[model samples]
Target: MVLVWAAASLAPGAEARQSAFDTRASHAVIMDYETGAILFSKNGEEPMPPASMSKLMTALMAFEALEDGRLTLDAELPVSETAWRRGGAASGSSTMFLEVNSRATVEDLLQGIIVQSGNDACIVIAEALGGTEENFSAMMTERARELGLESATFANSTGWPDPEHRISAADLARLAQIIIRDYPQYYSFYAQPVFTYNGIRQFNRNPLIGVMQGADGLKTGRTSEAGFGLTASAVRDGQRRIVVFNGMETERARADEAERLMRAAFTEFELVNLVEAGGGAGQVEVFLGQAETVALRAVEGLSFGVHRRDRAGVRAEIVYDGPLRAPVQAGDSVGRLEVTTPDGRIFSVPVEAAEDVNRQGLLGRAGTGLVRLIRGG
Candidate 1:
């Protein structure tokens, strides 16, 4: 059967206050990882040039290959003339100083891409994995779709300037979340400060990595067309936040804006546990069942992000169709317990049957029908 859910505000006049954050970036988004709630956003959905930030998608492809055994970390991939000329030293882009016709291990190349923002390394991996950079970009676009990145498109392995090579700030944040969630084993490469290849050592370009207390790994991007962009993630006390921004005027602005946004994300809001696992929200009547009623409970704990000052405005309600049919399983869905906070955020948790309800015997069913008819149920 189909169910329709309606939104209800739990607290009136408890709307979240406007965040006092001001950033120089034209597009930005800050999100809480655990709750998937957007803390602050400014033109976050507008697509803009992602520049080297697109390398995150490139890194994601490599990580997936590593996880699935299709590519090993120690596997050596060849550098193509195309990769060398266009993405290497000849192109005047970020390079890992990779030698033409030389081979680099997958692990080192990944470091080159992550730590050094090496456009050459990205092209090499793309060529190795997808037969050519063009094909690899197609793969990247397809993978972005598979991962639910709606506004992301890849024109090249390196986030080179292309009119079509654009991604929204929100999409970048989602990509960052996927990378951190799916590739924990390889995520540390993003945190590495420096990588030395071919007697050249380069530091990670991400501005927040060393300066921010909890900031760890991520990517930075810059091009004349895209200005500057950074996708940064940080964790503290088991909570993580992802921030994405683009179109900054300079590197210093990106760094300061990113840090301010991260700090506000962690400090401005609080996670509220509204209901515990197996906690009963209410009960529902049972029709033609051995028991007259069944208790409804949340299958897991329910939590929400709330403005710290508006804690008392949180409200919860249990909603479901009344008088459930008999032969109910212990975990059968009964209804939904919805909680809403002051900041206009709504969270819903499934409410399930607390225990099984067996169908009544023939006589019991007949009696129940008669009683229901007399009571006009």
Candidate 2:
């Protein structure tokens, strides 16, 4: 039973109803998944207790450790008395049902925390990463700021509730965005159905997983004080939509609104191919080098979510200072490719030099100069 919120607004010129999901949440926000651009937001920037959303940051720190090869997924983490006492079945909180003094692998613990909202797993992960929960909370805050999640602080790895442990829906969405974008491999764990530990079956709490198309995985949080909130991301036909809601009236409502927003985004906003990845909108000359000139292409690819009716009105332009000086690397940013609608909303895409161009050496310079002199002397 997904109780969707009333959409209170829509993007300008969009055909769909521009309604904001009427959330009882003290705060709510809707955003473009790909670019972190806000579509509609209310109290989106204010810090509030994140509940289990704090686990998202916990998982992210673990992921960063994994990415840098500082930790391995198969590594075992010892369950401390503090972690076990802080969580588990009798604690009236989420758990992988871990036993005190028993150990679980990093991968399994991650599944527990993300899929099951296991506070036990959160503490275990924090201990494994930073030696103690307090130190880990400090690390989480530092990393949160580094990731641009400035409106957040981590009082505990599990978000068990302290006055200072707070985060905004926008910051929560930002953390989710990084999880999906940077750690593609481990991020898949968020989509799993359940994490079975010590004979207990704990299902993922995210509601949009199976019901919504391309809604693979993300984290969800709920507490009486925090009301009901969710951070959801969905991908459709290569485009992604991310939405976060806090102060929703109910869990089902949060899920329903998430699905509705994603569907609307994919339906109303379509990415038209402007340029192929590593392909040219055009070419440019190199002042001096092994090559006289080289192709310049978008750093990634160029695409835009133009309203279906406005596709024909889209315009693209490459802005550069001038011809590039040689000694350019293959992937050097020389300029920006701007995409604008007839109405003038714009998206700036980066354009990069396609190949390296070495500057002419003294001998090479003299040879070129002598030839020029012979040609025009």
Give the worst 10-residue stretch by lDDT in candidate 1: 1-10
lDDT minimum window of 10 residues, candidate 2: 1-10
* TM-score (all chains, Cα) for each model: 0.73, 0.67
The digit string of per-residue lDDT tens for model 2 on 1-377 reads: 11111111212233333232333557765556776665445577889988887888999999989989877989998999988888887788877889999999998888998899999999998988899999999999998998888998889999887898999987888888888888899888988877788887877788888788788878888877786777878887777777777766787887776666566666655555666677675566665576777677777775555555555455555677765777899888878776555334456678788878889998887886788789993
Model 1 C-alpha lDDT per residue in residues 22-54, reported as the tens digit of each score: 467888877788666665567777788999999
RMSD of each predicted structure: 5.6, 11.4
Question: What's the number of clashes in each of the models?
Answer: 0, 16
Residue 368 CA displacement from its true place in model 2, Å: 55
Q: Which candidate should be chosen as best, given TM-score against the real structure?
A: 1
Cα lDDT for residue 49, candidate 1 = 93
Q: Model 2 TM-score?
A: 0.67
